[model samples]
Target chain A: MQKIVPNISVDCVIFGFDFKQLNVLLVERKLQDEKTGETLIDDWTLTGYHIFEDEDFDTAAARILKGLSGLDNIYLEQFYAFGKVSRVDSPKDNIWLKHQHEGFSSRIVTVGYYSLIDNSTVTLQLQERNVKWFSITDLPELGFDHQEILNKALEKLRSKLRSEPIGFELLPEKFTLSQLQKLYEAILGTTYDRRNFRKKVLQMKYIIPLNEKQKAVKHKPAQLFIFSRDVYERTKRERFDFSI
Target chain B: MQKIVPNISVDCVIFGFDFKQLNVLLVERKLQDEKTGETLIDDWTLTGYHIFEDEDFDTAAARILKGLSGLDNIYLEQFYAFGKVSRVDSPKDNIWLKHQHEGFSSRIVTVGYYSLIDNSTVTLQLQERNVKWFSITDLPELGFDHQEILNKALEKLRSKLRSEPIGFELLPEKFTLSQLQKLYEAILGTTYDRRNFRKKVLQMKYIIPLNEKQKAVKHKPAQLFIFSRDVYERTKRERFDFSI
Candidate 1:
């Protein structure tokens, strides 16, 4: 067996958006209480694993998330490193850590990574009944410092969305401007003037206009648009225009 | 001695600006070779130490720099995690590690932190003839993966300066407008039109104008200003304006 690096692990905060609400993927662990002989709190955590010796940190993050999203090349951006000595607070957490690795402690520092993906298109392999999606606002009791990790991830995502055109990763190929505005509102936890938002974004040449519109909606269909990667990549080298 | 964490370390990229150029602190290690009975590369490395079992990563980073800077409250921001199997490629590194702790391997994950400080005020304590500052552009051969760590720290610093008002940390209590512009140009590696730069920044409410200018300059003196911390703190919660 490969000798895993002692006292180190990688955790990922995978964010998913369905054009309306933001969600994150979390894993539940099974641990037993010694006195009662009963299953303890099913603590939820960001899906992660101990990194192997051969791969770099980026590759290790992707390795933990390989078969879950169905898509192979997920962009995982490392944001922060959580290194509180007491991150794994309770006795139950230590038991869970033992379950993952014999003679283990979650005192390890975790390199935090986050990515936004389209929720409807990919197949989410939950791995038995453990992994599930919880609303960003309604998270359950988390294990370790995973809650702190999630908040930092959200802060990073908000900052990233303000600077880059990464918000397109969360939406479908073609989306209405209203849907785009709502996506930003969800992530930023704020409201925007629809007319002003439309005016500013419409002036940008990168958000290409599409021919199709919503088919089954009751109200009049708004025009669809797609983010132009060719222009985004080229102009990304030049200067930023689409900022919050 | 307290048990140091196995296979884990904290490295700091202590960036100091002396008005003209950016400099980083590095330490040189001396070790004799086993076979030829000669000294090795005299490798330069970031001033770092192994994490204590009970200490958090930030505390560990601050602890390493505290003795060197002679300042107890060294703010160390965790930026990146460097995890590579071959990070300690040279035989000399392994030998040095063994000297520090028996049965030591370089398969360690190092958490990277960078901090900016004004060079003139603080007295830097160089351990032996070992620690010294070199210009960021003119770095020499570094030990292990320190050069890579330095590069990553610079990248993070640039991005951070673009979004936040962190550039003030490098400046004195008060500075001329030209000094501020030069700081940006130095960090970004690009020149900005003087008139446009001043006009844009003067419009900002946070850059408070002071009743002072250059005292002993031969040329015409420029007016000085200070970044208002109250305004910066209040506005930091809002959207960002100072960006690239």
Candidate 2:
């Protein structure tokens, strides 16, 4: 029997980029009436579960992610902790909780974790559960304040993508400047001047240019660039200004 | 009687700038032997308490800050959540926990909140609890995992100070360039070239120079400047790069 911490839980918002738009991985939550054998409620929610009493939060989040996706060593980060008393106030959420646990607590504090994965790299083994990636702009009505959670996660992701080089996690190893521009545009929901964007990115010491070009494409082959994290760590100076 | 959540607690790392160095607010945790009435352990820890079930995390953090400082609307930010099972493994911490609550849970997940205050602007009202400000460099062995919590809070503060204009929170409304430079130096633990630093700051349009000058100083009266948050908010653009 798993000893669950009654008041604490963990939720993961896995983000993926497929070169066109930014999407979030969500799991379909379906609850059926025990006695009548009928579907009571069905909705979408982020992948999550109650943390075990003996496990730490990071371990719990990793365990849940691996169980859902069968992937390890992904880019995971803890963004925020949502502790509103009415977070699970929806009737359907309450019903689902009641069915899942006996005498569930009225309040739960959920720690939010977000992970990034390359859309084309690995196969997600989520076939058993109805898991799918939904575009951020066209998300369905998520269950139990998960919409707010997802929104917060997106906000964190946007702020982080602007400053950090974590966006490479969602892109292929060898990528073109256009693909990189598309990624920034997709996540930030804005367009950048191609000339100015390329100039700025090219000036960055960590963005190393490669000798190879795109192998197969309809358009003219573009030069590929690789992000050198080692060079970034070695040559990075203490940043004095953040108002980039 | 106060209703408390056994497993969820909030720890506050209150940072104050005294113009020379960074200091953290700590409460002296003195435990006395029950039968002998002799002081067994005396040490310092951050000001914190278990959150009430009725309120949210922000509300709980604010309430704790207000109760300790008798001040409201100070600059408070939630940085990280510490959920390690062995956070309170020390014998002194365990003894204090046993003295405070009946049958306390073995595991506690503490949300870390950090706040900044100008040391000269307001007087702290923590005399009853023996709370005092200790310099970050010169500190005693803190009880529990408070030292780790304080270090994380400082890391967050350092990171936030570089990218955001939050360093002004520790300065007086009217300050000279030297004072501003000193403020940054104290927090960042590094000295900036005077001419270069001034050049960078002057280029920022939001840092408005006032006609007023310093009064009653030994050296020549330097020009005064105020951080124009209104102008900063109005003219702020979406940042594209974070690598300063």
Candidate 3:
């Protein structure tokens, strides 16, 4: 076997939005201890893997994400590197990993990445016993400080959403203003004033109004709008302030 | 012997502002090849070290900075992880590290961090051969991927400056409005309208003016001011718009 690059692993925090709520992709693992030979079943973790010797850092992350989800062209961004000695070297991870894989006999430093995708666009073939999407609010204790990794990813997402229109990635091709508002509310966990929120949206010329409306709806059908990245690139105001 | 955590390192990108320009912290390295006995000298790199077992990632980074520069209270922030497999696997670096350090026989995944400090506040006793501050613009080609790491760190610093009061860290305890403006212009690499810049700054309640002036100066002295963190924390507006 090709010797794995020692002490380096890639973990991905995949954020999915299903219109009303936020979700994260997690993989379930089961292993036996190296020292005690005790078995571990159904332990949940963020989708992660060891980096191959010939791969770039980003390519390694993209490889794991594509292999598991079978999806491509997803927007992935590196958020942080977690290198606390015990992050993987703790007794629990040490024994579990040592027994399962020979290459994992030493301390491992993991690079953390967060990917954003619309939950409705892709289907997950692995579930129950393997991989699943967990709501951002509720999650089980993860293996090897993955909980902290997910927390940091969410923080980056929230901060990025405020300044840029990245939330459009978590949205559909065409969506109503209310649907767009709900997406932001779900991700940010805050309510916005309807008037001000619309004012902000209306001011953004890149959010092009399309001649489409929700079909077969019992309530009033709202007009749909699409995000024009070209327009946004040409006209976004990036004036930074030092009031703070 | 207590073994170092194998294949994981932390590199610090310390950015210092000396009123007129930006400077970065660097350390010189001298190593000999394990195979050919070829000696490499006068190569510059970021202050970095492998993480010690039983230490936190942030704590390890802090320890490295403190140990190298004797600066304990500097503001350090994790920016990214450079995990391209060949980042340290190039034959030149591989043999050099192998001969000098046992813990680095395998691959290295380096975490990059950037620290901000006022240049006037520091007293560098490290003379010619060990450590020194080089202006960010006039930096030589650094060893390994340190140049890429430094570029990434500056990108982060610029983005953070847009939304937060982090640039204050690069300024002295007391400074004139012109000095503060120059700091922003230098860091952002752009010029601003004097009236607009002053208006935006004067509108900030946190930028408090004092009855202080330059004791000795050739030109007319400008009034001095201080940044009030408490006022800023309580009153800063952080509404981000995307009208572009």
Q: Can you tell me the CAPRI class of model 3?
A: medium
Q: lDDT at A136 for candidate 3?
A: 85
Model 2: CA > 4 A from native: A31-40, A125-128, A203-205, A209-211, A242-244, B32-40, B203-205, B242-244
Error of 2 at B14 (Å): 0.5
- Stretches of candidate 3 above 4 Å error? A28-43, A88-103, A127-130, B28-43, B88-103, B125-130, B242-244
RMSD of 2: 2.7
lDDT of 1 by residue, B184-237 (tens): 777777788899888878877789999888788899998989988787676645
Tens-place lDDT digits, model 2, residues A1-244: 8788888989999999988999998988887777998988888999888888888989989988898778888889898899988889988988888877755688999999999988776656465578888999899879999999999999888877866788888988899899889999999999989998899888888998999999878989999999999988888777566341
Which has the higher DockQ value, candidate number 1 or candidate number 3? 3
**How many angstroms is residue B108 displaced in model 3 relative to the true structure, after the best TM-score fit?**
2.2
State the lDDT of candidate 2 residue by residue for B1-244, as single tens digits.
7688888989999888787888888899888888999997899999888888788999899999998878888888988888987888988887888787765688999999999888767766565678788989899879899999999999888877866888777878887787888788888899989998888888888899999999998988999999999988987787566451
Model 1 ranges with Cα > 4 A deviation? A1-3, A30-39, A98-101, A216-219, A237-244, B29-39, B91-103, B213-222, B240-244
Q: Tell me the TM-score that candidate 2 gets on chain A alone.
A: 0.92
RMSD of each: 3.3, 2.7, 4.0
lDDT of each: 0.79, 0.86, 0.79
lDDT of 3 by residue, A128-147 (tens): 44778888888876887888
CAPRI verdict on model 1?
acceptable
Is 1 or 2 the stronger prediction by TM-score? 2
